[model samples]
Target: MQKQAKYIFLITFLIAGLVSQAQVKQDTLKREVEVTKAYTPTISDANKLNSMPEIDEEEADKPTFNYNIKSQPVFSTFSVTPLKAATIETTPPIQKGYGLVRAGLGTYYKPYGEIFFNNLNSKNTVFGIHAMHLSSFGDVKLKGGDKVDAPFMNNEVELFLKHTIQQSILSVDLTLNHDAFNYYGYPEDPVPAPLLEDEQSINYFGTKQAFTKGGVHIDLDDPGAEMDEEEFGFQLDYYYFGTKTEQRENFANLTFNMRRPLTSGVGLLDAGVEFAQVSNITLPADTAIGKTSSTILFAKPAWYIGDEKANVTLGLNAWFILQTDEETQAKLAPRINANWAPVEEILKIYAGIDGAFQHNHYSKIAYENPFVKPDHHLKNSMQQFRLYGGFDGKMSKRTTYKISGEYAINTDKPLYFMNENYYFDAAYNPAPLIVDNTFDVMYDDMNRLKLNAEILYASSKKMDLSLSVNYYSYKMDKQEEAWNLPTWDATLALGYKVTEQLSVSADIYLIGDRKALIIEESGSLIPEDLPIRKSFTLDPAFDLNLKGNYQLTNKFSVFAQLNNFGFQQYERWFGYPVQSFNALAGISYAF
Candidate 1:
């Protein structure tokens, strides 16, 4: 009963509180709520980890590497063992000498001498002096069996000095020459009363002709120079010529050469200028014939193509002349050339068209033909043109050959003819001696053709042989024949070395003669109409010569020469025959 009474009271109180809360919820009111702290949830780990295991690459597997070694250049002193050691040999140097002297005498009363003095093995300067003398005291028989003293004396002296300035060279040369000859030529057969035994001797009436010449040359060669520039070189030449008579001449010349390179030395531009002046033409005899001087200006400009194996040049050569004796003239010619070598050092072929001019100075005429008289101012010859082709080279190790042909046309070609003159000097006691014994020069136009062949054989065994032959054809314009010019010529030379100090040589010459003229005065001493010039053939000339040399010591040697073995009295010029079977012996010494 007491619990029931407590519950009933509690129930009554709860019911009353619930009724009040319901009334508060049904009423509208404003309320605010605030929180000051943040809440974080926490997790606690167990003993086991959550990650899975991975393979241990360092413990179970290893990496593989591949590499290679390369070779390189290394310098070191390393030697191999030789099987047998011997001495190393070297080649010996050649010996050089300073001075040389040679003297000889021939059976025809001929004496020859030569001497040379020079410096040896000089580094800066080279100097030399050379002197030569050749003289003959002999007589030559005329075509009519008449004898006359045909003596000749030749003397020459040369001095040269060469100095090196850097890569270029400077050279100075001086030359002196003197020659004397006697006029001994006579007409063929028909006897002249003036030269007969009854009359005075002709030798006493005649005088020896003496000619003297002096010359000097100066040159400076410098290959390194600029292109398009004028003065690349300095060259000078001068000469003075005098004769026994009143005739004299002076000549001087200057030359300049220029070059320009294109295409590295394969192609080049070349040019040259030459001014040659011949003056002082004097001599009372030739004065009235117009003693005029010759002045010439020559120029050549060419283009060079190709290289050492094959080459060609194309250009022109021109000339301007001022001749006081004739009209002034200008000339031109093609200077075209071609060369090819099909096999190097084996065969070479060449072809060219060229031209040239030669002065007919007394100095040259006397050298070629000593019988010339100095009473004229002759004209210079002009080579209009020339066409030539040839092939030359070694055929085998011991043999070489050359074959060539040439065709040329020239104007004012000098022809030698027999002098035909009549002079009577009663005041000098003259009975009209045979004065037509000399030679005179004449000018003419002519055409010439030539074919030549040559063979040379040589070996290291010290044996050599040379054979050559030439044939010529000529057609004269104003003259009947090519006077005294040969139509064919041949030569054979052989040499052998029997031992180290002994050697022998042999030579043979064959020459075909041309036309010659013989003039004779038949009737009057001085006639109005002169005899006509006629042409007659001379006999062929031949000569055979042998020579020997023995080297006795280091600086001494002996030589002997035998000429004209057949004693053949061959006639090389009109009314002049060579010595028969001459012999010469000499000794040479080098100091």
Candidate 2:
């Protein structure tokens, strides 16, 4: 078998080399012809100028004329329009289309086990599979995990379609996901213990609870016990816009666009309304534990005042949201933005007051409590308002800067993870502890402040650099409970155009330390101190392209490409690795 495989590989390599050579020869011939034609000259004046003569004072002094009629070659009397290159009749290439198919197989390694399992160790040799298809119509992507004990099966499928009409456009999207895979404990193993004291204990044998100290032994014979959860959804959008042109006007827009140009040098006018709906189906522990559906309707009308060099936008928005089996919340939001362009093309400044209200059933304790009676009940509503302002613009041809700040207010009862009843003392007071879930007029509001800044600089041909910093702090009514959370992220990208056909790039990302502080209500001397954890990661990548045409005949040619080099590991989330490095070189024959 090994000998046979070697022979096959050799044959494939030879074929690819032959094809590449042929393509290069054809491309050379074509380029040579283009160069020669570009330098070729017309012969119309050669004979006429020669016949007109060399030392005649009258001819030298007077304007030269082509008196040699034969040299003119009897030019056509009828006028002729040059034939254009047929315009190619190319489509927009389908903004979201697909034309290529990619598939790769690789190895993955990661540390895994129970969250706090002592046997946690890194596992290698995990297989990885990736498949992608892109075309002018749509795209498809598929990936799978390689090893056992992986978090989930990691499957996702999405579809998108767009259609255009005379003055309207429509888009549709669909997605399906199934990402629930975890370890199942054995009968002799201890049941998983609750992370929180008030949480109920679960049996170890059941797939729902994988870890526990002690529990009644239950048979793990159920077939559905190990099944993973599934979720899916779909979305659609339709947009329509029309325009009317007027003399001297800069531009006119008719749509749900909030900004419109004016005939005068003044700023623009903006107004629009947006509606969105989402439905999620969740099955936890093989049971329909949670499901949420919501619809939101909102509209914003804004105006840009002042000249183009300086302007301000004042807008108002109102939102109403309704959740199935949950509460209905409403909000009125407002925004203000200012823009200053000191140097029309070089520098600009911007600032704004962007505020919004968020209301949802999950903000209430009744909806958060999993063990509550009539699980879907309206209990309380939490409202959050944010005021933000920012400025972003170019500092030079290759540098840009952005700075922003935000202040937020969170009102109503504290947002707790578990149901409210679980936190109450059922033994001391049984009658379903009832308390108004309202923000205390005196001191129940939560205040948060955040400041952020980013800078990007690019060199003429080789390097791109970026840096950013974020600072956040929360001030609640309780002083000791208040905490500060700050995060800093930075990245640098460098690309070298080694040659006309080969290029390479290096990218690095850094994340600063992040700490989460939580105060538990334990009837003890003081709250237990939990250790803060930090994580770091690094990744890098490269690409190569060899493009040309190979002539099979005078009327036929083949084009090929050698793409994606080094196949480095790229990941956006922890524990989830992306496709491995692989080469995709294919040839297409054109006639």
Candidate 3:
């Protein structure tokens, strides 16, 4: 009886609620109709008679049926005024402009400062400065019996400046850069044992070791060793070829570009010229030991078509390079690149061809000879060419795939000697042995082919994943001295958004079978004798962003970067040990 009563009660309550809802809806509709009628005009007899006097008799006779149709007036007491036809004068489309300036000062294990500036006006310009000071000193172990003591130092500065200008149909850019590095050591010391070992070993694969013999090793507590080495060496050791070495380099570049619209369906025509200069100064043991300079001039003309949806460009480039105290070379290079969209906007295919001839002087520093008296001025020149093509497309809203392949070749030319009859006899000989023309010495040539493919999936809200694979093969011309260094590299990353304010990311990189052969001038090639230094590394980082009304803050972040995480001590070359697990953590804030 009670249950039945409860059921009846619930049914009655639901019915009453529905009835109330229906009454409210009907009242709202009635109010809207009444408001509409209040502003409508009624067709009274007087108004009809007045309107009829102006109508023609034929029109009146055609509508003689006793029918009455009325509609509400569109304008009421609270109505907006009718707008006049406005002559909208649009300001001619002014191009957008933007600028950015950023500066950062941080103390890592060392002190670091950075400044960056960018201008996005009619012309784009960018400039940056980076300076760092290390508070602690480190040691750089060398081969043979030499060692270099690198004390924790300060006052290291590097600067870069760039400017770009854009006109209606032309653009110009310029860049300047300077770099300086400081290291501590003494002159006349035997090459460090570690470095000497590296020089002698065919492959770098081993643990790092320190050499204990040969040069004078001064204790850090020695008052003389603590003085600024540059000034101390210049003042004290003015006779024995000085006691330190310093290197400085200056670089500058300029580029000019012009574009012209074409009448045909083809894209615009483009031409450009580039100039670059590099000056390297090396001071050793008190005096300027060597200086090398290089200058290059290059020009390119190209034709381009289509838009971002699809594009094809063909171009030819020519360059002339001249090096001080070296031979000059002229090169002609051509390039072609294209992107095709076959199905409107779904799939994209791309291909490119690049080829160039490069020539440069062999470094005499490696042989410890002065610039004026190079052991052998080797005319080392090569022709390099590559062809690459790829396809990228979306399979769905959340998945994408890309695949590419490249083939490159490097071929050497005949050698030319500056001195025809130079011979090798002394340790510091300025010439190489002149052998008979029939003496067949195989030059170095390489052919490489690479293939890469990647797939990205972002189907979930909280997680995104990507997988990629790369394959490479390097082949040499001389069979006995040839090397087949086939490598496969892969990477995987996973990220988690812990909260709106913080996130963490972890990634791993794996390399496989990074082995090769090392050949010597003695006509003997060592195989598998060099260490195959391949390993997997992990990088995990976290970031926190604390929001404020008019400021942003990140309190603390940590990163653990592990190289050769497997703890395998192998070197890409002999005697030089690769870095082990190195980790750093810091906190940053900005206003």
> What lDDT score is found at residue 559 in candidate 3?
24
Error of 2 at 243 (Å): 44
- Tens-place lDDT per residue, model 2, 284-398, is 2343544444555444445455766787777655555555554555555566778888877466777666656443332122212211122222222333567777777677666
Q: Report the number of clashing residue pairs per model.
A: 0, 17, 25
Error of 2 at 358 (Å): 2.7
Worst 10 residues of 1 by lDDT: 67-76
Clashing pairs in 1: none
How would the candidate models be sorted by TM-score, starting from the highest?
A: 1, 3, 2
Instruction: Choose 1 or 3, whichever is better by TM-score.
Output: 1
Which RMSD values do the candidates have, in order?
42.7, 28.0, 32.4
Candidate 1 lDDT, tens digit per residue, 1-591? 465445345434433432332211111001101011111111001100101111122211111111000010010111111111111001121255566677777775878777767664567676878888777787766677766677778888999776666645677889999988766555555445554454355432245688899999887664433332222344678888887765677778776544445443322222233333333443334455334566776656666777668888887776667766456566768899999999987889999999987667666665566665555446678989999999988777656778999999999888777744444556445545354555667779989998988776654355557677888889999777888888887767666767766767676777787677755454466678566555678778777777777777766667777777766776656655666676777777656
CA lDDT scores, all candidates in order: 0.60, 0.31, 0.34
As a whole number from 0 to 100, the lDDT of residue 562 in candidate 3 is: 26
RMSD of 1: 42.7
Question: What's the CA error at residue 282 for candidate 1, in Å?
Answer: 9.7
Better of 1 and 2 by lDDT: 1
